[model samples]
Target: MTSLSTSKLLALLALFVWQAHASLANSPRSLPARDEFVCPAEDIANTGCLGPKDCLYANPNNCNTFIRCIANADGTGTPVVLPCLLELEWNDNKKECDFPENSTCPPK
Candidate 1:
């Protein structure tokens, strides 16, 4: 190929690489801020009850008001905000907090 054509091709390739790099750099590393929802205590317990689950209850007197956020499996940028609950269930194959209906867990 001609020198001019080769230089133009190289410049185009460089521009493409730079744009790709920039896009990747700006891409979010974690879940986006809008798609998440808080899971409710009842759902987390998997007891099929809407009322508070006994296993997940927190002491009102000693409970703190901090909130925990979690991301969903979808690529959409959304996270669920959960109240810091007392008892947490650990499902070996599931995420840290997996409430069937609600995404955010109730505060402990």
Candidate 2:
């Protein structure tokens, strides 16, 4: 092949490799799961603000734990509300809802 044609081919091949790598890297590792928790209506309304597909839950520990639903950003499928645990002051130590054992919060 001519030198010009060879260069074009190489460029196209490089572009393909880069695109493939990016796609693989950006692919979701796994489907996001949902967690269940209970908070007062006022707390829920104030704490975790609802987003397009996810809900923000207040993290008791960091003040950033927001429970969100797992779904594509495009908003498809049944939205599942995920439970997030926050750290609250317990005596002198920070306390959070334990997993499996204390997965769901008690009724308010």
Candidate 3:
């Protein structure tokens, strides 16, 4: 009698553990983010304002330029804005984003 009761108790405990683990594994935080901010030419949709995840992205072909999605203040999204971060500038020859300290851009 005791053996059967103990076995049933263990089964119930195992079931409870399995349920807890399953819920956590399927939680919302485990899901992937749908919005991604692409730099320069990679604007998903020009919204003018950058989302929380928006930031400078590396471009191997343009060291001085990055693919950034800048938000427009007028509430109309139609342009692709390419602004270099801090000290970095777009380099046409390197095909990658580069810092200005180590390189100089010709006066425009």
By lDDT, who's the top model here? 3
At residue 12, candidate 1 shows an lDDT of: 100
What lDDT is reached at residue 98 by model 2?
45
Listed in order, each prediction's TM-score against the native is: 0.29, 0.28, 0.27
Compared with the true structure, what per-residue lDDT tens digits does model 1 show for residues 26-67?
443432333333435434344333232212322122222112
Cα-based RMSD of the predictions, in order? 17.9, 14.5, 17.3
lDDT of 2 by residue, 1-108 (tens): 999999999999999977864564344232243223433344334434344322333333322233332333333322222223233211112232244333343323
Give Cα distance to truth, residue 92, candidate 1, Å: 36
- lDDT per prediction? 0.37, 0.38, 0.46
Error of 1 at 74 (Å): 29
Segments in model 2 whose C-alpha atoms lie over 4 Å from true places: 31-108
Query: Residue 32 in model 1: shift from native, Å?
Result: 13
